[model samples]
Target: MKVTILTLGSRGDVQPYIALAREMIKNGHEVVICTGATFQRFIEENKVSFYPASADLMALMESEEGRDILNGNGFSLLKIIKFSKEKIAPSYRKSMDDFYQASQGADLIIYHPKALGAVDIALYFNIPCICLPPVPIMYPITEFPNFSLSSKKSFGPVLNRLSYKLVKFSELPFIKEINDFRGKTLKSPKRKAGLYTYDINGSPIPIIYPISPFLFKKVDSWKDSVFISGFFFLDSEEETLPNEIENFLEKGKKPIVVSFSSMPLKNPSIFRKKLVQALKKTNNRAVVLTGTSGMRFNQEENILTVEKAPHRLLFKRAKGIIHHGGVGTMSEALLSGVPQIIIPFAVDQPFWANLLYKKGYSIKPLQEKNLEVFELVQALEQVGNKEYIENAQKIKNIIQSENGIHRAVKHIESVVDNIKKE
Candidate 1:
């Protein structure tokens, strides 16, 4: 079978789909990944076929407005909407055209939830497609209406519903634009504009969520078409660790790995200073990953600050992790069986933090604006606590037992088989 997988965003978003693609390839299926142009080299390195999309978004994300948006402030949604209106929508149309032209013989399409055009294109071609929920799948869960961070709500179910209503209403224009694009480009009938709805082609598309049940409880009313595959991390064949970091870990004192996971710190100097002060307060060593934000730290004997390192290789030997609570980062930390301190900045970070806290695997999350040296120190101390470690170990066992990529492959195959039979 030939499968085309489409995803966008940062490395966190694209990596899992790559993992699933690789798994599909190993299972004797031809696989191709359609993603950001920046990842072309990454895909090539992985020996997977690649389809390039716009590369400008990554640069846009590094601009001042982009940084603010990432920090959970500023007009991110408007900027995103404007970008989509001017740049992404057109890009999507072209990319989908290219994908369809390239994938002439594909058996199935697996798409990230945000890759809205992929679904439309699949519908136009009458091909089987599946949605991969990189984060929580939010439409309108009666129990938790605010499952999507895009919604605006403080805390109640009514508020959540109101939030969803507002968000849904806000996107009506974009929905119409997308449907019109589909209608003109593919000559298909118009359909609703939500992430998971029946398209013009009258196919019931399945959404595959890559998170474990431990983080998100399955809603009873959730469509049977949705499949939950546990966390998928594309294992990088090249594992390189700095000699200094390796030596620091071998020094015997438990080291806390601190990272913000590519989100820019709101105030880098202040954040770094407080982090330095917090590490000084504790005897444990520290390795801080400053991802593209250019936060400089005073290099001390006990503390090492680097631009970036692969989490899959580094998280394994770390005593604990402190991060931005990205789904991918959280998955790595959990799989490492180490406790974490989640300092959620925006988007799905808060949700993941809340979920981990409820699961008893993380310390109470420290919002970036409200974070203090003492709070971080306290959280680091709690990492050594037996209960947190025990619970983390249990979660680790469950995650390790599940073959995420294989499960996803099987589900995709099932979807194809069912479609063929129909």
Candidate 2:
């Protein structure tokens, strides 16, 4: 079977799908990844077909307007939509065109929420599509409020589920663009409503969420169509550390791995200075992963900075971690069995940070705006506490037992088999 996977956003968002695509190919299926043009080479390197589908989010994050959004404490739903519309305007046409062309002759399509247009594209082709989100935001969860809502406080289970309904309603504005694309670009009946959510067969698409159930309980409200596959990780081949990193690790106590993965800092100088001060105050050594920031720093005796490293391998050797709470990074930290100090920026980051804290594997996170040196030092110190280390090890065991990619592949094979029988 020919399988097409559509995804968007940062590397964190696209990386997992690539892993899934590779697995499908190993099982003797043709696989294609439709994402931003920036990842075209990376996708091809993995021996998967590549299709350009969105703007370079890293470029956007570095733009003045994008930096403002990231630096802001938080944004209301409308504000986020407004900023997103502006960013999506220039590339929206090209993205739709790319997805349409790439999806041709595919038997199945698995899509990220950012590529909602894929639903209609699949309908037009008379194929099945699965919704795959790294987070559980696609469906309402009575376990807690929707992570994007920015309130950690829960009113009740009813209100928790209602929060997701509000999030769904917010998409009403995008309906026109979705239907307009369908009408203008593809040969299909004009959608009656705005969003192309349902399949041509009038069934709710199956949704596969790749997150560990230990992190958050599955809600009883979801249907059988919704499946929670554990965290999908693409294991790397045995990686040798750089000579400098190897030397540093061999010399003293394992340094804390500090990274704010692709998050554009408004005042990078100030952020770095405070980070250095915190490390000094706590008298801890660190290896900072500065991804795409083009950030250069004069390394002190205690700190070493690099453009990148294998997080899965590096985190296990670290004393602990200090990072922006992107789920990809959080999963690595959990797997490493090290306490984390999260400095959340926005969106679902705060939710993940708070979840880890509640589970006793992390210290209370410091919001980006409130990231003072003293507070950072305090959080660093908390990582050394015995209880935090013990709790972290417990969570690690649970995550290591999960087989997310294998489970997702089994389900995908079932879908393909059913379609063939028809």
Candidate 3:
């Protein structure tokens, strides 16, 4: 069978689906990944067919407007809607065209919620589409509001369920372009506004959420079609640390690994200065991962900075993990059995950070605006507290036991088998 996976947003969002594609290929199926043009080479390097379905989000995040969104204390659902309409709406035609062309002759479509075209595109082809959000935001949870919209007080469960409408709000800005793609491009029937959620067969689409049940179990309210598969990690080859990193790791205490992953920092200089001072004040050492996230720092005697490293490998050697709480980073840290210090920027990050802290996998999340040298030092010192470390290891054992990619593949095959029976 030919399988097409569609995703959007940052590398954090697209990386897991690439893992999923590889799993499908291992099962003797043709696999294609339709994502940003930036990932075409990366996809092909992994031996999966590549199709550019969206513009590179890294470029967007680097833009001034995108920086504003990230630096904000928290992103309200309303702010995201405004941002998407203003920045993302203009690119819809090209993105829809890309997805339309890439999806041709595919038996299945598994998509990130950001891949809004998948719903209509699946309908156009009469194929099954599975919603595969790497994060738990797309499914409603009774405990909290969606992502960054959470407050010090509860908005209550009614609003908590409604907050997952982030998917609908995020896509609202592109509806006109989606309609244009339907009418002018695909010659497909125009569907009404709101989420184009149901499959062509008039069934509620199945959703596969790749998160460890230990982090958040399947709630009673979720439907039969909603699955809580464990995290889908790539079957990575053995990787070696760089000479600089290797030497640094051997020098002193196992240093904390600090990375904000793909989050763009608005004031990186201030952030980096505070971090370095905090580490020194706590007399702890660190290895900072500074990718294109705008966190550039000169290597100090006690702190080392590298552009990239294998998180799965590097995290396990660290005494603690400090990061922006991207779902990908969260999963890797969980698997590493290392306690985390989450400095959430925006969106679902706050949700995950709070959850981890409450569950004793990490310290209480520190907001960037409220960030201080003393507070950071306190959190860094807390890293050695035995209780948090023990809880992290317990969660790690539970996640390591579950086979996320294998379980996800089984579900995909089951959906296809059901289609055949029909």
Query: Which candidate comes out best when scored by TM-score?
Result: 3
lDDT of 1 by residue, 1-422 (tens): 88888776787788888788888889899988877787888888888999876533565577766666656566567776676577656665556556555456777888775565676677666678877868754344444555455422345655554555544343355576667666877787776656445333455667778888545564643557467778897887677898877877787676788888678877888877877778778787888888875578765768878878888778767788989888899899989888888988777888888878976988889866867788888987888899998988988898898877778788878778887898
Q: Please list all clashing residue pairs in model 2, or write none if there are none.
A: none
lDDT of 1 at 212: 84
Cα lDDT tens digits, model 3, 5-88, are 888788878889888899999999998988877778778878899987665666677677677676673657787778777667
Superposed Cα deviation of residue 172, candidate 3 (Å): 1.9
Q: Rate the local accuracy (lDDT) of all candidates.
A: 0.74, 0.79, 0.81
Global fold similarity of model 3 (TM-score): 0.92
Candidate 3, position 302, lDDT: 88
Tens-place lDDT per residue, model 2, 1-422, is: 89989887887888899889888888898999998877787777777889877656656766766766666636466766787777765465467667888899999999987775788888778888888987878777676788777547876888887777664454365566666777788756555432444334566677888888666564666657578778888776755678888888999998989888887665677778888898899999999988744356894879999988889888999998988888898888989999898887767788888888887878998865556888988888988999999998998998889888888899888976877687
Candidate 3 lDDT trough over 10 residues, lowest sum:
192-201
Model 1's alpha-carbon lDDT is 0.74
Report residue 138 deviation for candidate 2 (angstroms).
Answer: 0.6
Candidate 2 — worst ten consecutive residues by lDDT sum?
A: 191-200
Which structure is stronger by lDDT: 1 or 3? 3
**TM-score for each candidate, following the candidate numbering:** 0.89, 0.91, 0.92
Model 3: colliding residue pairs:
none
